[model samples]
Structures are given as C-alpha cells and as structure tokens.
Target: MNSSMFNKSNATSSIGENIYHYLRKGIIELKLKPGDSLSAKNIAEQLEVSRSPVRDSIIKLGKEGLVDIVAQSGTTVSKIDLDRVAEEQFIRFSLEEKVMMLFIEKSSSREISKLEELMEMQKANLEKKEYNTFLNYDDEFHSVFFETANKQMSWELIVSMSGHYRRLRLITLWDLEIAEDVMKQHYDLLKFIKEKNIDMARKTVQEHTMRIFAQKDFMVKKYPTFFKEKNDEIDLFNNFKR
Candidate 1:
C-alpha cells in the first residue's frame, strides 16, 4: 500500500471500497464463480462490516457487469453471454484502434517506454501463472495508449465495457498459446507505436482485438453455460420501437 492509497478521509475505508475490492477481486480471479449466489449478510459478517457496505459494493459490481440483480431471485455473480461480449468488443475495438493510431502519432519516447515497462511486468506475471496480476498489468499497458487520447470519458467507458467481458479474457489468459500470442502482439504494437508507424499500430490493435473475437466461437462452445439466456421476444418487440 502506498501513502497516497492510505491517506484516510471520510471516503476512505468506507464499506463501499472494502466490499468493492473483495468482490472485484473475487470476480476477476474466478473465486466467486459465475452464477454463485451472493450473500450480503455472510460477506458482511466475514469482513466484520455492515450489510450497507456490501449492498453498495454489489451495486458497483452490477455496474461493472459482474453481478446480476433479480427482483425475486436476489443477486448472483453474473454469467457471461457471447452476444454481450461481442457487443462490448466491438465498442472497445472501435475506440482503441483510433487511440492506438493517435498514440503512435503523438507520443514521445518516454510514453512508449512506459508501456514497455508494463508489458515486461505482464510477461513476468504470465510466467509466474499469476493471471490476475497479468490482467492488471495488461490493462495498465493498454491504458498508456488510451490516456494519450486526452479523452478521459472515453477511457472510463472503455474500461467499464471491457469489464463486462473480463471472464472471457481470463479464459484466454489460461491458454498458454493465447497468452504468448497476446504478449507478442503487445510487443509488435509497442514497436510500431515507438517507430511512429500509425498505420501499423492501428492495424495491429485491430488484429489483436479480432484475434480474441475469432476465439468467440471456441469460447462459446467450451463454456456454453457462461452465457445468459437471451429474451428473444423482448428483442423482437424492441425491433418494432418507434
């Protein structure tokens, strides 16, 4: 923990952050498996906190697409759906490709080096089979490019949508071949950005995103239970919207 993180105020140590980190990590590491029922009372008791904090944390998780709230059934860890994953990837790829191209055009050598350092950390975490660590570092690695856009709102939107499909990304991380491919793509993208190759950087980012999308069918087949059931009647009705 750093001093900046530890500095306490009214907001500090609030039940929200405590509960949020607990569930966020659980979901990220698959500790709380998909469709597992969330017990607010149990969690609050375990952490020696009140249910209010846990409830707030649950709402945060819901916003991140990690929890499902049902009026009659209570809250459960969210199940992944292929269509939602595809939709999120499309949005992410749309923004990030442009961000990568912009970064390649405008970044200094210092910024490229920062990304390289994060990639190195990601590689080490992967070698150690630390999937969560690798995911965090990998996010940092990508954020370098996004931050260059100077569009903070876009970055937040990207991360929120990306969190929706985080479980799929976890699956990709488990396959060593896919992990190696990701690392290689990271290196390639970094090299292009450093060399001011905007076209190559943009293409590389698109290819990287598409590679994951290509694995969608495989993932869906292997993890059929991951997706939620779609309400096709509602979709059909929505299609007739004014």
Candidate 2:
C-alpha cells in the first residue's frame, strides 16, 4: 500500500473509514492485487495512525470478501470469485431493469437533457482515452435512473456488491473496442429512453448489463490468478447404465 494514497488531514471522520476507503480503492483499482499481503503495522506507520484503525478496516474488508485473514498466514487481498461476481451481476441486472422501467415512465425533459450532457461528457472522455473518467460518466448515467426512480439507496447497495465486477471492468476498459461498444450501448439506451420505448429500453438494458459475461473466457484466460475456476464432481451413477 502506498502511504501517499492515504489522506491523513481528513481529521473530521473516523480513521477506520478513511483507511477502509483507501484500501478499498487500491484493491478495486488493481493496485493491491489479489493475494497481496497487507500488514496492519506497516499500514499504520504509513498512514500515521494506530494499528487499531488499520485492523478495523481490514476486518470490514474481510466482511466484504475483499480481504482475507488467516490465523497463521496473516492478511491478504482476496482473489475475485466468479460466483460472487455472477451473483452481483444478476442482482444489478434485475434491479436496474426495474429501475429503468420506472425511469422510462417517470423521466422528464430536464432529466433527459441531463443524460444527454452526461453522454457528451462520456464521448469527450472516450476521445481523450480517459477510460476511468468515461466509466464515471457511465455510472452517473445509470445512476440517474435510480435517482429519478427514488432508488439511490438501491444503487448504493448494487455498487457495494460490485467490487469484483468493477475490478473486472477496469481490466476490460483497456480494450478500446470494448469501451467504444459500451458507449454505443449507452447511446442506444438513452435513445430508447427518449422515445419512451419500454420494450426496446428493457432489451437494451438487459444486453448492456449482461455483456460482461461475454468477456469471461478472455478475462479468465488473461488473469487466471485473479479468477476462481469451478471444480464440480462428476456423478458416476448418472453416466452408468442402471
């Protein structure tokens, strides 16, 4: 962990929350990669805080499956579990589809204009090859649906459950073609929203939300260590003649 990444001057809030956010960002950004060891004492020294807060932050991350604490082996960043990623993706798709339905029914001209502005920003970011910034715009664009539908808390919950998925997205964002395709999908969704075409909007949203699954084989091949592979037991009786 880089000490410079931690802002020590934010003296108004809990030290544990500050450390948690710092470490969480590092993990999500792939700076502190899977299986990387984390030392509470070292982190405390770096952040100029007590080990107590660092320990607390690690515990919180452990709850989120972003950190793993072993009795004999110490603490390390957890590997991205594909099952967890799939679960979060399912939850997001389900909830966001509902939110989009509500948004299509409730959105006003002003909200549509705001989305257009965000789309412009996304295009600008893409032109600049600022993929991270583009992703922020992408998030904000979807967030408008939840916000307009009065589901900001639901959006937050989805975000909270999407750490592994976000990390995977960060990896995929390196591909310009994939990034451009995502932008195009965003535009299509926005067009459907403007036309109040509910069925088309739902279809676009479903395809957009589930597009990441198409990248699974490539992602797993490229980052074998980051992803988990399933090992299911074969049923001998099922394969045998009775």
Candidate 3:
C-alpha cells in the first residue's frame, strides 16, 4: 500500500478522523485490498502520530464493517459482503424512489436545470475518461432530488449504509461502457422527472439502482479474493431486517 496516499496537509480535523478518512478512502478506492493486513503501529509511524489515533480509526472502521479485528491477531480489510451491498441497494432505491416522487411534485424549472447541468458535467467527465469525477457528478445529480425534497438527512443515512456498495461501484468504474450506460440512464431519469412522470421516474430509478447486481458473477470472478461466499438459500430481507 502507498502510505503517501494517507498523507494530507489539512490539520483542521482530529487525527483520528483524519486517519479514518484516509483508511476509508483507501479501502473504497481498493488501494487497501480486501483481506490485506493493517498494522496500526506501522501506520502510526508513517503518519508520525501515536498509535491511539490509528487504533481509534481502526475501531471506527470495524464498526462500519470495513475492517475486521481479531483478538490476539491483527486487523484486516474486510472482504466485500454482497449481502450488505444488496441490502443497501434496496434501501437506497426505496428511499430515493420516494424522494423522486416528492421531487416531481414540487421541483421547479431551476431545479431541473441544475440536474441538466450535472448531467452535462457527467458527460464531459466521461469523455475525458475521468470515471471517478464522473461518479461524483452522478452522485450529485441524484443528491439534487433529495436536497430539493428536504431529505438531506435521509441521503446521509443512505450514504453511511452504502460503503460496501460504493466500493463495489468504484471497482466497476474501470468499465467505460458501464459508465456510458449510467450516464444515459441519468439523462433518461432526468427527462422523466422533468416531465413529471413519476411512474417512469420510479421505474428508471429502480432499474438504475439494481443494475449493478447483473455484474455480480463477473465481479466476483474477476476479484475472487474481494468477495465472501454467500449462501444461496439466504433470505436477504430477513437477514437485513431492522
């Protein structure tokens, strides 16, 4: 792993939070591979901080299911749990569909214009092969509906629960075709929303949100070490019930 990736010049945040963000970003970007060992002491030495902050960050990451801490053993980046990803996908799709319904009812032309601007940005990023930046624009496009509908807190909650899904998405960014397809989906969804076609918008959102599942087999085969074996008989709804 490149320790320099963790190095940052900002000093506004607490050391623990800074370490947490660094490790989280590395994990999401696949710099810290699944099952890779994480040495708190070594990271502390590299960051020129005491182990306390690193340990705190590790514990926080553990709570997020991003890392596993074994007693008398060492910490390792957690394998991508497909079950968690599916659960999060479901939650996000359901909530966002509801938010889109509300947005369609109340959205003004100005808000629609904002989404169009984001779509243009996504197109530009795609043309430049800036997949990461394109993903950021994609996120912002969806977020506009939530922000306009006064659901920013709900958006935050969904994002907090979407770590695994987001990491999986980051891996998929290498597929330029998928990026292009997603941009088209964004455009179609935006069109539906602008037309006040709530049903079409909801369907579009559902299809777009669940489309990643189609690549499950390919992703697992390509990155075998990053995924854990999930029981075929497991009931996703039951397992993820609150």
Candidate 4:
C-alpha cells in the first residue's frame, strides 16, 4: 500500500518478490512439505515468470532458512531445524514476558478488549477445525501485547527470524488437544492481564511460550519427515577424519 512496499523502482513488485512470498507461504503452511523439491524452472513456468525471478526468490527464501540450497543435490524446503526452534523459543519466552509485563502496566480497557476479540476469533477457528486461521490469530494475540507496549518492531523481529519455529507450530496444532491447551494458556494470560497480576502474567507467558518444547516429541513423532533428527547434532565432518 506504501511506496517502499509497492514501488517498482526497488522491484518490490518484481516477479521475484511475488515468488518469494508464494513459496514462503507454502513452506510455512506445510503445503510445501520439508524435503519437497523446489524446482525454480517449474515454478517460473507455472507463474509465467522468468527463471531469474524464481532463482532470486529461492535465494531469498534460503536466507530466511525456509529453503535449503545444497551444493549438488539442488534446493528443497528445509526440514524443521529443532535446534533453531529451541533457540527461537528461548528468545520469544524472554522477550514476550517483558513485553506482556509492560502491557499490564500501560494497557487500557480498550487494548484488553482487543485481545478478547482475538480470543473469540480463535475459538471460532478451533470449532471449525481451521487450524491455520487459529495460528494467525494466535500470532496476533501475542502481537497485541507487543504493539500495546510499543514493541511492534520487536515482535516483527521474532516473526521474521522464526521460519523453522513457525512451521512446527502449525504442525503441532493439527492435534486439537494441543490446540486446546494453547487456547487455555491464552485465556490464562488474559485473566492475569485484567487483574494486573504481573507475577501470574509472567508465569503464564513462560508456560505459553515454552509449551512448544513440551510438545516437541509429539510433533517430531507425528510428522517424522517434517523435522530433522537428533543425530544431525553430530556434524562429524567438522569433528573427525574419515
């Protein structure tokens, strides 16, 4: 809608940018599964765009850790990197706790009402088995705290850097049991916020953010190909000789 976002001078509307978003969504939504081939030529043909743009898009996705570009085997959607997921979880838990606590001090009834609306939307999504839409609201629910606290940029930083973590979240939500737990945690957070209970709010933030790890095993087992194995931890090429 703005100059920087839509201007053709910076090539923001270039075929490459379009392709990047298209591929990025597929990766995040699990429409393009991990290890699925990413044929730039094929995509270029499908979208009626030049191969150059498709290649450019692939490179951009690679930088985001959403696509893997191997030396000889060609590119694919990267598997969920659990190590990165854990790191992201830690970053989110620490940062959001501070943000939510800040919100409790400064947020008004209006902001609280906004959060309540999002919760209702999430509930409707859950009832309809719209897991993807639920996750979108889940993101907005957390973002409200950051935005209220004047930390919108901080939330953007987390989201822009959380490709691996985001995909796993969608996969985890396939089990409505986990979705219910997540929803309860959101309500608990709301309760604490309304009460101006900083201590309880902080505790709920921790539980809410760290719940992903609690469900790690379930996620990995349920979607085996979706994640990299623990054995990947040993990068022996750097540690030993053949």
C-alpha lDDT of all candidate models, in order: 0.76, 0.83, 0.84, 0.83
lDDT of 3 by residue, 187-226 (tens): 8898898788999999999879877877766788898899
- Model 3: worst 10 consecutive residues (lDDT sum): 233-242
RMSD of 3: 3.3
Pairs that collide, model 1: none
Off by over 4 Å in 1: 1-13, 229-242
Q: Evaluate residue 62 in candidate 3 and report its C-alpha lDDT on the 0 to 100 scale.
A: 94
The deviation in Å at residue 233 for candidate 4 is 5.8
Candidate closer to the true structure by lDDT (higher is better), 1 or 2 = 2
- Candidate 4 per-residue lDDT, tens place, 1-242, comes to 22243235655466567667778888888889999999988877677667887898899999988899998899999999887787676678778988977899999999999999999999999999998899899999999989989999999999888888899888888888999999999999899899999999999888787777668777788788888777753343123211
RMSD of each: 5.0, 5.0, 3.3, 5.7
lDDT of 4 at 151: 95
Stretches of candidate 2 exceeding 4 Å from the true structure:
1-9, 232-242
Q: Clash number for every model?
A: 0, 0, 0, 0
**Predicted structure 3, TM vs. truth:** 0.89
Candidate 3's C-alpha runs over 4 A off are: 1-10, 233-242
The lDDT, on a scale of 0 to 1, for candidate 2 is: 0.83
